[model samples]
Target chain A: GQQVMQIPQYQHVQEGEDFTTYCNSSTTLSNIQWYKQRPGGHPVFLIQLVKSGEVKKQKRLTFQFGEAKKNSSLHITATQTTDVGTYFCAGPPHRFNKFYFGSGTKLNVKP
Target chain B: EAGVAQSPRYKIIEKRQSVAFWCNPISGHATLYWYQQILGQGPKLLIQFQNNGVVDDSQLPKDRFSAERLKGVDSTLKIQPAKLEDSAVYLCASRRVRRDGNYNEQFFGPGTRLTVL
Candidate 1:
């Protein structure tokens, strides 16, 4: 079975600070996706990284995929109050139909 | 376009009771998934359906949990003789078919929060 390990189970930062969460999988993944879940809300798809050593950005957030295709990271620059939520990394193993999710990194930004 | 739909946003039941949750995915989406999220934890895949047939349910507890998607449109998840540990939020998600074989975008419904005492 494939599994993903996420670092910094919890993160607390000032409103203008930065935050990052790392995800490492036990097996190589075809692609990886990131999701955000707000308090008392359902998880929402954020972005996906495919290709080795790929990097993508959305406004102040950046996502990166390791060259090995088994690790990923999400970094938020100058985080704001709205950035407070749990971030999850997920993906399916090669040649598998099911997707496995990381334990998640909860972020709390103080305004 | 309408997003995924779920019923009874919240549920409370005693241990040993049975409870069911319903989900209606987005129109024309070919993939639907059910996930369980405990307090302070990320969502775990419980079952996944490709159209009306199950794609995978390896993480589901067969002794008490079961799910079905009839007519390939609507789905339901049932838990019989629920235990206190069954307390969690059940989320339903759907994704449109991609010709490129990449399923990276998924729309989620407001999950059903279950509390078993």
Candidate 2:
């Protein structure tokens, strides 16, 4: 079975500070996706990384895929209060159709 | 466009009782999934369906949990003699078919939060 491990199970930062979370998988993945879930809300798709050593950005947030395709990271520059939520990384273990989600990093941005 | 839909945004039940949840994916989406999220944890995959056939359910507990996607449009998850540990938020998600073979973009519903005492 494929599994993903996320570092810093919880993160709290002052407004305007930076935050980062890393995700590593046990097996090689075809691609990796990121998601965000607000308190008591369902997860919303954030972005997906396909190519090896790929990097993408959205406003102040940046997503990177490790060259090995088995690791990924999400970094938020100058975090804000709206950035409070749990971030998750997901990828298919094999062709089995089940995507394993990382334990997740819960962010609490204080203003 | 309408997003995934789930019935009974919240539910409360006693242990040993039975409960059921329903999900209606976005129109024309062929893939459906169910996940359970405990407090302070990420969502765990419970089942996956491609149309009317199941693609993976290796994580489902057959002894007390069961799910079916009849007609490949709507799905149902049922738990009999539920235990207190069954309390969690159940999320339903759907993805549009991708010929490129990439299915990382999935839309999730508001989720049905269950509390079993």
Candidate 3:
């Protein structure tokens, strides 16, 4: 069975500190997506990486995809209270439309 | 634009009791998905529907779980004789289909949390 694994199941950081979560897949993927879920809220789409070795940034967040398309990472600089949430990386198994989600990394930002 | 919609934000039932969840995807979206998210975990795909047809349900427990999307719009998921392990949040998501095989972002609805005792 194919699986997406995320490391650092739980991370607590000071508001001004940096944080990162890594996602690795058992099989190569055609594309990968990142999502965030605030406590008690639904998961919201944040970004997607399609090309191998792609790197995209959104404000303080930086996303990177492995050259082999088997891993990805999300890094947040200067974490804020609003950054408290669970981050998940999802990838399809050689297809589009269906996804296998990572176990997710829960982040707790303390001020 | 309106987001996906789910009913009965929360549910509580004893083991062996039957339960059903309803979901309405965004307008004009042709792909809908049902997922189960246990506390502290990510959402797991239970079933996926491309319009009125099922694309994949390999992960669904066929003996106890069933889903339908008759009009290719709103959908429902039912679990009969539920077990204590069935406790989790059910999330419904939708996305527009692209002909170019490009992946699209999924819009999720506020999930229905189920607590089985």
Q: Comparing candidate 2 with candidate 3, which one achieves the higher DockQ? A: 2
Docking quality (DockQ) of candidate 3: 0.84
Model 2 chain B poorest 10 in a row by lDDT: B96-105
Can you write out model 3's per-residue Cα lDDT over A2-89, one digit (the tens) per residue? 8999999999999999999999999999899999999999999999999999999999999999999999999999999999999999
Worst 10 residues of 3 chain B by lDDT: B97-106
Which ten residues in a row are the worst by lDDT in model 1 chain A? A92-101
- List the TM-score for candidate 1's chain B: 0.98
Question: In model 1, what lDDT does residue A44 have?
Answer: 91
- For model 2, the stretches where C-alpha displacement exceeds 4 angstroms are none
DockQ order, best first, reads 1, 2, 3
B27, model 2: CA deviation in Å? 0.5
Q: Residue by residue across B31-116, what tens digits does model 2's lDDT show? A: 99999999988889999999999988988999999999999999999999899999999999999989987775999999999999
The residue ranges of model 1 lying beyond 4 angstroms of the native Cα positions read none
Off by over 4 Å in 3: none
**Each prediction's DockQ against the real complex:** 0.89, 0.88, 0.84
